[model samples]
Target chain A: MLAALAFVAGWPLARTIWFGFTDASLGSLADAEWVGFANYLEWFDYGDGEGEWFGLLADAAWWEAVRNTLFFALVTVSIETALGMVVALVLNARFPLRGLVRAGVLVPWAIPTIVSAKMWAWMLNDQFGIINDLGVRLGLLAAPVAWVASADTALIAVMIVDIWKTTPFMALLILAGLQMIPEDIYEAARIDGVNPLLVFWKVTLPLVAPAILVAIVFRALDALRVFDIVYVLTPNNASTTTMSVFAQQNLFQFDQFAYGSAASTALFLVIGLVTLGYLRLARLDLGN
Target chain B: MRRAVGLAKRIGFWALVALILFVSLFPFYYAILTSLETGTAIFEPNYFPEVFDLRNYAQVLGQGSFPRNVLNSILVATATVAISLFLGVTAAFALARIPFRGRKLLLLTVLSVSMFPQIAVLAGLFEMMRFLGLYNTLGSLILSYLIFTLPFTVWVLTTFMRDLPIEIEEAAIVDGAGPWDIVRRVFLPLMGPALAATGLLAFIQAWNEFLFALTFVASNETRTVPVAIALISGASSQETPWGPIMAASVIVTAPLIVLVMIFQRRIAAGLTTGGVKG
Candidate 1:
């Protein structure tokens, strides 16, 4: 089993790391010569402030993708975490038809990201989209807005779709954490006549913080690597291109295999460091 | 006065519940409604199902390589689930029941493997597929999907195996049941729920995976549901075939929705345990 995982995952990871150092291309993977630090240098080169910056670090397009990815991750994670907490709190309450609602919430999450992106892309169509019609009807917009087409609103459009599809996952995780809190703690708070809001702030939030943090880290990592939604919703649009999208475009479309590998290697390092930092901070033990 | 305040709260809460339900389900409901509308009906912004046209569904299923893509999705997802479960069960037994050094490290390694960005491995994996002559084939997808699916299966199954009462295992052991015998004859029977939950989750992951399917498979017939739906275009590049797209989306999502509804409890348990406990 370990060998299978190593071959499928580990070996490829090692190959990518190795390729990041060499001038490997799609045409010549085996015959690629050693070019230690050249790919990295080219990626980080400042270009002496001349005309037309080169390398990923100096490239405006790469920076745009990085900014879009981080902004998307930050906004979506915040909104989803807040909304997920609310939904989990609501669902945690005893209510009629709760199971049905729970099942309903999972529908969006269960749907494929590509499918959801397509559905939203159609719904956000400027001309005959229901969203525009409703926005007009509600006096939200004077006319139809091209939600995914225009650069101004494309990131927001992607974020909305992401929040819709993934908030359920966050809610489900927090709901599990909520269910774990002992009933007596709430009962005690009620007997003490504490403010309901205060009770939630003091008792519930602290107890569920671990689970919420875990969910946030997971979602953040996922959003950092956002690809399918951006790719399908706004293909080749620099305004919404994420790190993964940029890497994929370069790797496959441009066939700059070594340069793309460098980008991907950098991404892998960032994700790896962040994950390690989070694990260290959270002190989560998988063996337990 | 108190009664009035309580009444207002109840009304507000129910309203919120209604809003949540609408937000959660309205898109799919609209997709279904749109799928049932023909030619010009879809152009108009109609909320409810005005027309009962089955042509869109017929069109998506009847034309092109959609049915073939759906078959490919099913085959790949089922194969992934079966293989992941088989590997996960045996690995979980070793990691869960066996007392050995470096077990923790091994388990952590499995956990971290799932978290690697797919892009990080794409170039290498693509090269690998070509080298093995598996590019554009279903074999590439099924194999690449293991990078994501196996870790979760192993971790979740290991957690489930740990929670089982140790007394039964000891009893079986006293009767001379070896590790393989114990895992197969004894524990596997009791692990039906865990197996089902993990298998379903793995199936969903494989079905929804896009990057690998998009990159690895080039032929139209080998495309999975996600790639096929994504690449679905109209007769001309000017316009998108929304009606057929919605129809196909509905078809692909229906099975998942049904499965989720049926196994909500188990799925929730699996996710929470995997997330929180891990």
Candidate 2:
């Protein structure tokens, strides 16, 4: 099993990084020459002491993908964290049919990303979408807005779906943290006649902060590599294109294997930083 | 004034509950409504089902390759789950019960393997699959999907194995059973619930994966349901068959919803174990 994991996880990642340094194309992968970071950046000399740097790092679209991915990760993680706290707090309370609501929250989480993409694509349809219908009826919009198709709202649309899908998961993780705090803490606060809101701000938030941090980091790592939803939600919308989507399009659609490999390697490094942080956090928690 | 504030709070709480339920489920409900509409009515904006029509379902089923894709998904998911469970059980056994050097490091390594993003190894896996002549075949999918499922299964089952009382294994050993025999005879019997939960989770992961299925395979016959629906609706909006697409989406999601409901607790057993979708 260990060996299988090494082969599955370690070997491929190593080779992918190695391939990023080569001039390999999908057509003739075997005989490709080592380009030594040429795929990432190449110095092109036009003589007369003039030279230009070229490669993935120099590409505007690649930078856009990076910015978009970072933006998505930052914004979605923030919104999802706040909303997830609310959901967790609500579920923590003893209410009638709380279990039902909890289960319902998982509904979005349960649906497959591609299926949700399609479902949302239909719902966000400008002409006949129920969202447009409701929006117009509620006077929220003067006209039907193309949610996924329009460049202005495409990434927002993707972020909205992601939050809808992942907030429940975040809530559950936070709830676990909330459950870990001994009941006596809250009981003592109640006995003191402290405001419920103050109790939450002073006690609950501090206690659950670690778990919420872990959840945010995990969800951020996921959002950074956002692909299927973006790919399926708005196929060719460049404004909403993320790092994973850009890498995939280059790898398969555009057939720039080496360039795509470079993009993948860069993304791996970015995510690797977060994974290391997570590992450190996990270690600290375990040490306790 | 105090009573009024209390009443307002009550109303606010119920309203929040209603909002949660609506946000959670309205898309799927609207999908069902849309799938049941036929002809011109299918394109018309309506919150409720205006017509009860089975034509979309029939069309999706009759799309020739849709059923084949579904079968492909089933076969791939089943094969992946079966193999993952088989390997996971033995791995969990060793990791849980066996005393060995570097065990702790190995266990941590196993746990971290589950966190690998699919894109990190896409290019290399594509090359390997093509070299093995498994590209565009279901074999490619099963092979790549193990990168996700195997780690998860092994980790989940291993956690479960550690919590089981050690006396059972000791008794098996006293009965003169070998390690493999004890595993098969003693541990396997007790692993029913853990095996099922891990198997179901692995199955869902394999079923919902898209990047590998999309990148590795090209033919309609070999494409999974997700990619098939994606290709069908990938065309421009006017020609995008929303009704058939909705029907297909519902078909793929129904089984998952049912499984999730049944195994909800099993899913929450670990961190992000219920991540059947990405």
Candidate 3:
């Protein structure tokens, strides 16, 4: 089992990192020559030792992708966490048909990412989009606005799709934490005549805080590597181009395999650092 | 006055529940509604199913390798789930039940691998596929899909395995059973629910995987449903066949919805066990 994981994940990752150093193209991997730091950054010397930097690190598009990925991660994770908390709280409350409601919530989570992306893409179509039709009719918009196709609304569209699909996951995790809390804590608060709102703020939130923290890290990392939604919803739209999309596009489409590997390696470094920093700050000893 | 306030509170609670259900489920409802509408009627965004015409469904299902795509998805997902569970259960026994040097580190390593971005390995996996002559074959996807699915299955099953009462295993040992026999004959049966949940989740993950499917497989015949739906583009972006696309989306999501409905409890449990419990 470890062997499979090593081959599938570890070996490929090692090869990817190595490819980052060598100037390899897609078709002719065997013929590629080693050029350390050239893919990441290199000071190209000119006449009289005047030089300019060039590499994946120096590329404006790569940085734009980084910014877009971070922004998407930040916005979507924050919204999903907050919204998921609300949903989890609701689920935890005494409600009729709770099972049905819970299953209903899982619908979005259960749907395939690509299918949901395509589903939203169809609904966000400016010409025949339900969103545009409803927006115009309900005074949400005066015109039929192109959603995923338009530059201005494209990133927002991607975030909206992501948050919609992922909030259920966050909610489910938080709900599990909520269930883990002993019911008597709330009972005591009620006996003391504590305000329900205060019980939620001072009691419930603090107890479920760890689960929320873990869920945040999980969702945030996943969001940072967002690909399918952006790729399907707003393909080739520069405004919504994320690191994964940008890297994959270069890897195969543009045939800049080595450069794409650098971008990918950069992304891995960011995620790795974030994971370590989070593990450190949270003191989450998974070994336990 | 107090009675009126109580009434308002009750109304508000129900309203909130209704809203949650709506936001959670409205898009799928809209997708089904859209799928039912035919040609030009699709342009009109009626909230309800305006027509029950199956033409769009027929159109997508009848031609253009969409059904073949669905079959490909089923075949790949089933194999992935089967192999992952088979491998995962054994790994879990070793990781959870046995103590060994570097075991903790190896377990953590498996956990971290699940966090890997698919793009990070795409270039290399693509090359690996070509070198092994598995490129464009379904085998390439199954192998790449394992990178994500295997970790989750192992982690979740390990958690489940540790929680199993040791008395049963002790009794099995007294019956002169070896470790392999204990795992295959003893714990395997006991892990039925956990295995089902983990396998379902793994199946869904494999079914829905797009990045690897798109990167590894190159032919129309080998395309899974996700990639098929994604590649189901029109001549102009504006002229996209929404009817067929929505139809295909619904088709691809239907079995998953059914599976989730049947196993929602187990899946929810599996998801948290694999995630928050860590």
Best by DockQ: 3
- Model 3 lDDT tens row, A64-137: 99999999999999999999999998898887788888999999998999888988887888887888988999
Q: Could you tell me the lDDT of residue B112 within candidate 1? A: 80
Question: Backbone collision count in every prediction?
Answer: 0, 0, 0
Which lDDT tens digits does candidate 2 get at residues A216-263?
A: 777887888889899998888889989999899888889899889899
How much does each candidate deviate from the true structure in C-alpha RMSD? 2.8, 2.2, 2.1
CAPRI class assigned to model 1 = medium
TM-score winner, 1 or 2: 1
Q: Score the docking of each candidate (DockQ).
A: 0.66, 0.64, 0.68
Candidate lDDT scores, in order, read 0.90, 0.85, 0.89
Worst 10 contiguous positions by lDDT, candidate 1 chain A:
A44-53
lDDT of 1 by residue, B1-278 (tens): 99999999999999998899899998889889888988888999988768899999999999899999999999999999999999999999999988999999999899888788999999889889999999999999999999999999999999999999999989998999988899889998999999999998999999999999999999999999999999999879888999999999999999999999999888888877665111
Model 2 lDDT tens row, B1-278: 99999999999998988887888899889888888887799777887667999999999998679999999999999999988888899998899888899988887777666667789899999888888899899998987888888887888788888999999888888989999998899888888877887887788778888899999999999999889888875357567788898989999989888877777766655444433233
Interface RMSD, candidate 3?
A: 2.3
Ranking by TM-score: 3, 1, 2
Segments of candidate 1 deviating more than 4 angstroms: A43-53, A280-288, B276-278
